[model samples]
Target: MLMKAALMETLLEKFYKNHQILHKESFMLNQQNMKIFTQSWRPYSTLQLKGLVAMVRYNSESSWLFELTSVAIAKAGFLVCAIDLQGHGYSDGLAGHIPNIEPIVSDCIQFFDSIKVDHPKLPAFIYGESLGGAIAILVCLKQKREWNGLILNGLMWEISAKFKPTWPLEKLLPVAAFLAPIWKIVISKPLASKSYKEWKRKLVVKNPNRKAPGKPPMATALELLRVSEYVRRHCHELEVTMLMVHGEDDVVCVYRSARFVYESAASEDKILKFSKYVASVDW
Candidate 1:
């Protein structure tokens, strides 16, 4: 019994030491800082996809925003920065008043110019979620030669154009977007992922004092759909290769949209990849 007790005590000591090492490693990893260029700009106004927005991104980092989709970019082999488009984050602007698809593309171009990197020919990768994907596609269309790669998550292209007929919605879009109204188009229903819910809940839990703003402007839907249709017809114009990924269980944005992008985009070097949220990738 005495020998057995001594062995148990030794095992406990080893376990405690291992736990402490893990704790320290985690703290260091979390503390790691990726250089970010945070700026606010008023992109030239157009018909839709308008307003001044804040851009919080990392340009000095070696790799681009490829490794992580959610959260402030993780330090990866690729330099990373996640942009919160205008009228969305800390930037100034009314929620409504998106002019048209052209402005959306222009904003991204403006962002690239504002960054002013030495290498105009380096492999710059961008990741956009939902509406961001739509803009990402548009940006690539304009400057295909300049960028080397693209990444998108839950792209917003799947939303039907037949949705909210343009003539009717366009007339009211300014009003609704001004109101920042919410419209239930393609809700996740019972199929919603628990992980997203947990993530959302934790975010809210962590910041209980702050309430997330209402749905984006109704004009957003109008501008997004218009952009989607435009991209569909002009997919042949996109020249940059894109690496695509979408969730199998994503209900808000369907999986077929990624397929459409792969099949339709003019990019010859494009590759399609599938991944789940919160999963780790070695590359």
Candidate 2:
């Protein structure tokens, strides 16, 4: 029995040793001196990389499943990297409290720019999902012509009407936010319930780093609305090569709003795809 156990352990070690990708996890201090969790994946061998992909996660998502996606991309010959946004994952901040989007955007730019510096010659792409998609757009806007392509999955150009707080609550959001920034407001349902397919919902919620499912903080909710409006205003200014994918059934982010932004962007090389049975968290 002892010999058999030793053999099994050796086999497992060899299997991991031969894995085709190199995965790394580290932390970096942002401008505010907060330690932000970051991760990267690249091909293990000396194969020439096709490009670099910088990823951003959704508002409530952490580095868990995002790391799987990165490894897949890395195996396909790209260097993939992602940062855990403040207040999410292993990063430092108040849990799920984002009073402003600009600083978050700045953090992404700072991290992604540093990664780009290491791969200056390779073509680079920025990819984001859900709220991350909105941040990816903001990143492209801030660094016009720097990225080779921008890819958005279930882009949250605007919050779905079905998910927003009811009329009176929506109208009173600003006042509530002013009085109690951390106050959680009751919305329709937890986004995870609506955004993920039946089978995938379990996988997403199993994330240990995930925040509890409930209403968003008053300030964060209000700021999301403002950010959506800001993005809509600047959609016409987007001129990067782009590919946008959104699910028609997505109730967390407005599908119509995503299509509107697709049509509104100035990118000559752009494609918009709609999937019928998919949801915002289908990824």
Candidate 3:
């Protein structure tokens, strides 16, 4: 029995060794001198490296499931790296507060550029989900002709009517934001509940780094609306190879808005895919 157990342990170790990936985590200070959490994954197999992929997570999401996605990409022969935006994950800032997106965009650019310095010859791709999609677009715009490809999953081109503030509240948002930047505003439903399937929702909420599901801060909500409009105005300038995937049933970020951007974008090689019954993070 002892011999059999030893053999089983040895076989398990061999299996893991064959499939192992190099995963690392670290902290970097952004321009604002805030500590930002960063992670990277590289496959240990003998396969030739294909390219580099930089991932950006949506608002309120950290490195939880995002790390799983990164590992999968790494296993496919690409070096995958991701960063936690300020105010989210293990980063240092006011929790869930993003008053201005430009700084965050700058942070991503700085980190990605640092990584690219080590692999200047490899094709680089930027992948963003939800709000991160908007950030990714901004990043590409800032560094025009730098990235090889851009992938947006459930991009938040426009906040869904089902999710945004209602009539009077929408009109008064600016005033509220000005008066109380940190005050949380009421929304229709918790984003996690609407964005994930049952099992996935449970896993998402279980994340210790995840901010509690509720209304976003008044300032953050206002800034997001403005950011959406900004992206709409600039999307036509996008020339990188692009792939956009959105769920037809997503109520947090409108699918129609993604279609509009897909049509407007100047990328000669762009594909837009619509899934039947997917949600925000389901892709």
Candidate 4:
């Protein structure tokens, strides 16, 4: 399984010019969101890519990035599954509510199982962006057999935030987890040029179909903290043939982590690429 990643803008344009989409089955979302999903369901499966971003945001710009990436991989003749993580996109979970990375990665396994039920013994690969990249990494580590290669885009190892007396906030993060469930914070800025600040909006927030800004659920935040603790104490646990891309100015997640990931990866073939603008590279 060979994995590759591209920037939202360039990838979208290439996808638009050279791809096709066809609807497949509708992956059920959480109970509350089923109504919205049902209205325009039946999205692309491996054989099709027609109904890409509509599931998350009816006309979202970022839709095709995932759709195209999945399609390109499939077209090139590989078994691939594009996921909605836990609470985002058209998966079965609440928005911004993640109890832990384990469950989400578990869902990923179930998804692979669903695929295996149809095509047993087939291999698979993953392409993850932002936090999704971390989820992909966990899959490779925890479910080693499930993945072959990984393409990580803006993968996050650290959350950029200001916590005065960081220790106190770290201790209270749990209690605050429940009491302040609805409180959303802008923990960091995009790691790109000022020019890209406006452009990235299409992939994450400004795009009508994107569901990423959904507040990180307490459970999800807890998992993030756990990942942070692990990285702080044991980043050496990472072991995968991953291609990591980061914006030189990315602030949403620290650039230093990208360096750490590149330097600390256990795989000899791992490649790290940094850029001021978004791009897709061969690693």
RMSD of 2: 4.3
TM-scores, all candidates, are: 0.59, 0.89, 0.89, 0.65
Question: Which parts of model 2 are misplaced by more than 4 Å?
Answer: 1-19, 281-283
Question: Could you tell which candidate, 2 or 4, scores higher by TM-score?
Answer: 2
Residues 1-283 of candidate 2: C-alpha lDDT, one tens digit per residue? 7897687557544643566766677898998899888877788764599999999875654455666677778888898889888887788998778899888888888888889998899899999888788889998999999999999988876766766667898888899999999998774444655776786677777665555565668898888889878899998999999999888877677788888989999999999998975555421
Per-residue CA lDDT of model 1 for 62-108, tens digit only, reads 11222123213221222233333334333323433344556445545
On lDDT, the leading prediction is: 3
Tell me the lDDT of candidate 2.
0.80
lDDT of 1 at 70: 23
Q: Residue 110 of candidate 2: its Cα lDDT?
A: 87
- Whose lDDT is higher: candidate 2's or candidate 4's? 2
Error of 3 at 79 (Å): 0.3
TM-score of the candidate numbered 1? 0.59
Per-model C-alpha lDDT, please? 0.46, 0.80, 0.82, 0.51
Q: Per-residue error at 228 for model 3, in Å?
A: 0.5
lDDT of 1 at 139: 75
RMSD value for candidate 3: 5.4
lDDT of 2 at 83: 86
